[model samples]
Target: MILRIAMIGFGNVGQEFASMLLARREWLLKDRGLDAEVLAIYTKSRGALLSKRALDLGKCLELVRGGRNLSEYGPESTSLSPVELISKCNADVLIELSPLNIESGQPAIDHIVAGIENGMDVVTANKGPVAFAYKRLRNLARSKGIHFRFEGTVMDGTPIFNLVEKTLQGCEVLGLEGILNSTSNYVLTEMTSGKTVEQAVRAAQKGGFAEADPSLDLEGWDAAAKITALANVLMDADTTPKSVDRQGIGGIEAKDIERASSLNKKYKLIARAEAAGEGIRLSVRPEMIGPDSTFWSVDGTSSALTIRTDLMGDLTILETNPRVTQTAYAVFSDILSVLESIRAGTAH
Candidate 1:
């Protein structure tokens, strides 16, 4: 099968996908019996344009790394910005990995709504818009009969959606919990370095684990958003970001970390969503778990989610990574899985 992919965000995750699509071109064609093309990538300003049809994968990577090109098309000056690209691009699948704006979900929400309306399938790693408009956007996609796959939105790309959707199909997850944010975890891990929370956050941003505005992860808003997505999709509940009570690690004073050390109990951003009767309760907060506790060991930007099922009781405790390398691979895994299912006409 052949496919055309429209990548909406050219950030670290977006660029990672581009690189992956290039690296695996030969393998995907020879092994998976799949032929594909990255139509284009819409980024902040004049996006990137590469036609792998003629260029070798290695040459493509060289151009991307140098931020220059050797094609008839000049680099950076010939492509549309992410916004204009979303509204104007053409493709069978739209990969939306744009940055998340919690307040508006802006471009992402608009992009997704527009994509579905135009009859294009969407796959994303952006949690802000999904966590904000789960019901509205989900209904829209379902009505349009488009596949909205978002496997990398939560974990370090640990296959959470289908882990719950398909693997535990007949079961019920009463309690969902995990280290949903890696930025905060990294900050906490650096507590012994004597760096202030602000200093640690800056380091995380420099390392590409946190965003320019790290409040989303530090304030627990990022984790809250993930919990909200889980509740809405896995639990079949209609909930919004505001509905999920949130608390961040921003308020943790230097003394608190010191105190935690004295008590031998550490603090970590724990996100939880529980089935409370007909309604669900979700929250993101920094809690103190003991030295040997399960959550206490989940450090840095790595996240772990444990699902308490009815039949199997407590099963696997899944973890998600924050690196784009892992996340982008997860994106491709999901893309191929969904595409294969679609081709077989057996996807649900």
Candidate 2:
């Protein structure tokens, strides 16, 4: 069967996926009987519609390279809202790479619901809706018998979710911890080297590790969102982002990092959610990990998740880069795996 695909939010990550589909067009068609193409793209910005073919890459890339949006490159194409596009598009799969709207999960939620309701499989990089309303969405997918993939959400391009679902099947996980936000990690590492939060944050921004408005990362909400999603997938519960107790690294002064360093410790943003005696207690913030700890070595924007379980104690550690890759192989890999599992009549 052909894997006809459409992408929402044509940003850095979405573009990455588009390039991947183009590069691997022939390979997927040949090897897996999947013919993937970016059938449609949606964005809130009206300027995003200024381009060609409604699916042109050269023009889209030119816009991105110029720090302009697709709308600036446009001439002719239907302009519709994201939800409407999902309902109307003739795509077998809907790929969601929109920015997280923490309040309502907005356009992401709207797009996901529309896609699945219209009998389309979905792959997402957005964490807001998943962290907030996973059970509802998954149940919706279950009822529709459509695939929903979100590997890039928890950790960029990471196998953490799949590792839990596949490698650690039936494993009773006791606790979860990770450097889930790359921007925070990079900033904290710089702070540990004597840079101020302001300074480190600037460096991260210059390095493209942070957004122009980086409050989500500075506030710990980003990692919190991912951790909450993990809790739902690893355990179970459609918990909201507000449900997690959050503490970002913003309050962390350079002195804190210095003091930790002097004490043979490193400051890292550690996100943890545990199956406590009463219930699940979740937290995300900067913590002082000892020099010898695994987290201490996780410098830069790379993220690592450590899963502690009843059977194997600390069983597996998974890592993923902070940035979306040049291609969408990571996301495609997730889709392929999910498809293979269904073909085998297995749970993923």
Candidate 3:
């Protein structure tokens, strides 16, 4: 089978995914009997590319790496918007790798809707769509008889959603707690080693994981979004990030970390969603834990989640320090799963 792909964003994760796809081309064909090709790549400012035949992903990576616009690819480049590409590209899969719009899940949601409306399977690593509009988009996909999957919305490529959906059948997710934001967790981990919050944040920024304005991570909004996404998917909470009772590490001083260390404890930014009556309650806050805590050693860019399920008791999954490759793998694995569903005639 040949799967044509239309990607809505060509940022870091998207670039890494394309590189992986190129590297695994032969293996995919020989091992899985599948040929995956990128038909279109749409970017916000850099430009877009579309072609009936498979576009050269290697050249696309080269141009992006060389700091050149995709339009420099000559005639293959087009001036079409993302929606137009989704309508015209005739791709089998729509990969949404767009940056997170925490305020409101815009253009990403718009692009995904266009893909589903155009009879394409959808895969996204953006947490915004799941956190903001999971039910509606999911229903739309079901109505259109397309597959919709997002395994990268939380914990990079750890397969949180897939774990619950595919592996743990008949189990009910009662609540969840996790160290969701890499920046926040890394900053707190650095503080444990005697670095101040500001210095730790600077180090995170230099390390390329934290944004220039790290407020979203430091202020707990990132964790809020992750928890909201998790609850919306696993527990059917149907909520957004704004509904989180949030508190940031901004109020934490050096003395706080020092005090925690003195008492054999560490501060971690924890995001939690618990079943509350017919609704779910969500919160993100800085809390101190002792050596006995599961999150005690999850430092740097590492993340961990503990899922409370009725049948399986408590299950915790941990991912060590992750790079863009993990997130890229999330998209890749999701695409493969979509293809599997397609082959099995269970996509709907």
Q: Could you give candidate 2's per-residue lDDT for residues 1-348 as a string of tens digits? A: 655566787777777776776777788878887755565777666333422223666666667767776656545355777777777777777888888987767768878999999988888888887888788888898888877888778777667777777787788877898888888888887776678778877888898878888899989988889899888777774577788889998788867777887898888888898877768888997778886677767887778888888776795464645556822556778778766866776542
TM-scores for every candidate against the unseen true structure = 0.88, 0.90, 0.98
Give the CA lDDT, 0 to 100, for residue 335 in model 2: 73
lDDT rank order:
3, 2, 1
Please give the lDDT score for candidate 1.
0.75
Instruction: Determine the backbone clash count of candidate 2.
Output: 8
* Comparison by lDDT, 1 against 3, better one: 3
Compared with the true structure, what per-residue lDDT tens digits does model 1 show for residues 1-348?
Answer: 777777777667877877888878899999898876665565564335544343243554565566864343454234555546555556667888888777766779888887788777788888876787777887888888778888888785788787887777789778788888888888987875588888898888888778888877888878888888777778776777777789998888879988988898888888888877778999888888897767777877677887778977876565645567878987888788768767876533
Q: For model 3, what is the alpha-carbon lDDT of residue 338?
A: 92
Q: For candidate 1, which ten residues in a row score worst on lDDT?
A: 46-55
True lDDT of residue 241, candidate 3: 95
> Model 1: runs farther than 4 Å from truth?
48-64, 68-89, 316-321
The superposed Cα distance between candidate 2 and the true structure at residue 45, in angstroms, equals 2.0
What C-alpha lDDT, on a 0 to 100 scale, does residue 133 get in candidate 3? 93
Candidate 3, overall lDDT?
0.93
